[model samples]
Target chain A: MTATTDTTRDRIDDALVRLTPAQVTIAVLTIAALGFVLLFAQEPMVHDSLHTFRHAAGITCH
Target chain B: MTLTDHLVRGLKAGAVAGGAYGLFVALIGNPLIRYAETFEHSHSGGGPVVPRAVTALISTAGGVFLGILFGVVVIGALYYFLEPAIPGTDGTKSYLLGAAGFVTVSGAPWLAIPPQPPGVEQALGVETRILWYLLMATVGAFACGLSGYVYTRLRPRYGQAPAGLGAGLVFLSIPVVATIAPANPVSGSLPAELAFVIQAVTGLGQVGLWFVLASAHAWLLRRDRDEERTGYGRVDHRDPTEPLGVDP
Candidate 1:
């Protein structure tokens, strides 16, 4: 009975660890996407497309 | 709820809010920008210009796109991760995150560099201004994290109201940090009234975005809880030690 309880406790401990690998992967992808839209994507046409947005959102764009 | 569930809900909320904001940009922001662009031509002559209609269309589309992005990434992912550590009910947590986001992204940076209308002359190069803006944003984000941490630490010792008020005071550091940061040297060629009004509109639009995003997210979470309650034998198998919003 004690051994079974210990196993259950161990399972509980494992579940308690927050942020699975899937969650981290999503966050990393999100940051990359944000960088592309906000910082990179600097071709003239792209800049022209995002111009009003950049200014309105207070990003430094010229 | 699982993080994925939260993310989907956040994306839905973001799409709706972003679509509305896009309309706002098209109706209000784009015309103001057009007026500002006329002033830019007076100084340096016209570069290639996208037509007004094209820009308005792009603004609406882009707003929806970004709203979804921010809703999932910032609101969904960040909120899910931080919910345990954040000292408040889920509703309060959502509102706090929204307010913090506004401060980090908009309010803090604007102190040093107000968003420029096209005619404003920036003394620094674009690279320098961008660098300064990034640095300000980082400081603002840091301040938010610090304040949240402070609240968690103080709440047990001092109780809720005092801890909440004390933690809020920590945000005063943002203005102090901005005062010390590099300043943008902007000389406006646009009419003073025009510049002021454009800045006002942009700032207000951001506030609307965050407000809608948070409220919708909280409402969705509440709806889920209500469903779970009404449905019989829906056991919550999550560990009590774990924070709220985790799915079994």
Candidate 2:
């Protein structure tokens, strides 16, 4: 295997081993919260707003 | 810190930043664009204007959603990529990084690829324009990064402030290069005044958004540190100068 691939694998392995329970919980909860916001916040009230806001803010997101 | 903690922390920061950005867009940005649209409409027939209440509600929602996105993305990248490369840092150091990032992501890029409102005739197709914008943004960010790396390398010999000024000059030159590069069709329909205002805000507003987002994120990080607890009903505190995972 190439040196770069080995290094990346090593980094990922190190990261996986290093995570604590508390840390894992934090990440999971944060993801859940973010998903919730993305799904619910874009309802009729904010859905249209995103387009206007995107234009005003200067660039198209997608 | 463990990867999970880092992820969570970054997510929190991103959410805060994104929310602030969304709010600014909803309140100030939305209104500004709507007004600018008038100029656009004068050149091209306008559609019916949406009600103010509807706009407000939508923008507010957009604000919250974006706040979460920014908090997660920017903060996550900081922890994952930059933090590993540098020493561990705390909320105290976040401001400098945040400001630098702001300049890289939005400020510098916008100089070359200024935002255009509707009715502005453009020669380039959408895909091409977007590709150009992405390229310009990358160049802007690269300039900022290279400037910092050079400043640190030069600091001991030149003294800190002078080295920083030199770096600042170098950092700013990238955009000038972009500006002077081959010209695009440019905005055709809008009057000079309105077009300029829209362009100005598109760039400046990002700076403001990043500022608020960083402040909120720093506050959250500070609070996280304060609430830190160990298994034994004791508070775990560390010297502020040290990075988060480092021992005293």
Candidate 3:
């Protein structure tokens, strides 16, 4: 690559590298949220049982 | 380090510090308060002021959670927006230095309230409580910023960064001690022995929380240093030969 093009590419690469941590953190948090949702969705029986227990105990679902 | 770098470092440090401190307060500090209360009652003739220890424990937990959340959000915003605006900035260290310094200095005010006597509730009046929260938040943010600034200045000379965490401890202790040493005696209100026990336990808890926070700050600083060196190589490079981009 030409010197100018090489420098531009290097700058872009540097920018990407600098931003990776934030991107990864976001990605991880997103995945965790999705996992939580999936768990809640799939475990209807458990959820129902817990809800019933809470209701029986006179605990309002706030 | 650039403005963005400083901001990132500060955010990381603040989050860790806040979380650590919050955990300490919730788990250890709250329990200590209960212990203090129990000791106070044992010494005094009257019954316990707070009927249930669970209530105080829950409150302490809620306060800690809120404090951590507030600390993270406020510190994150300050670093992300404000750090870059300052002129002649090179690295994140300056911002970190400023933040660390602020935390150390601001926490000093809480030291005036005696540990045993008035108790956390009575010693910290409504106005004082509000002020304390505001001050803690502000100081925490300032400390992160200051740490960033100081880091920037020192990084060039030393090559490898020191967390400057020792300074943070000294700063944190000033407020902790000051807050514990009451200026006036609690006379005619309650028995002195009861007050002393309550305050001592509560004060110990506060000290533990402060230490946890200081450790968190150190950890964050170390993490940032590692990120700077390996995660993002040579962040100090500013491309002096090229014109600065202005794509608004």
Q: Each predicted complex: what DockQ?
A: 0.28, 0.22, 0.03
lDDT of 3 by residue, A1-62 (tens): 11121232454454465567787588458645642332222233332322211111111111
Model 3 TM-score is 0.39
Candidate 3 stretches greater than 4 Å from native: A1-62, B1-28, B35-57, B66-107, B111-185, B188-194, B197-204, B231-248
Error of 1 at B130 (Å): 1.6
CA lDDT of each candidate? 0.74, 0.61, 0.41
Give TM-score values for chain A, per-prediction.
Answer: 0.46, 0.41, 0.35
Candidate 1, B50-161: lDDT as tens digits? 7656756775677777677778877886776676666678788788888888888778877777788888988877777667777778888888889988888988899988
Residues A1-62 of candidate 1: C-alpha lDDT, one tens digit per residue: 01121232443343345567786687688778766765446567677777777666556677
Q: Arrange candidates by DockQ, highest first: which order?
A: 1, 2, 3
Q: What TM-score does prediction 2 earn?
A: 0.69
**Model 1: docking quality category:** acceptable
Q: Give the CAPRI class of candidate 3.
A: incorrect
Q: What is the C-alpha RMSD of each candidate to the true structure, in Å?
A: 6.8, 8.6, 14.0
Instruction: Report the C-alpha displacement of residue A61, candidate 3, in angstroms.
Output: 30
> What proportion of true contacts does candidate 1 retain?
0.38
Model 2 ranges off by over 4 Å: A1-49, A60-62, B41-60, B84-92, B226-248
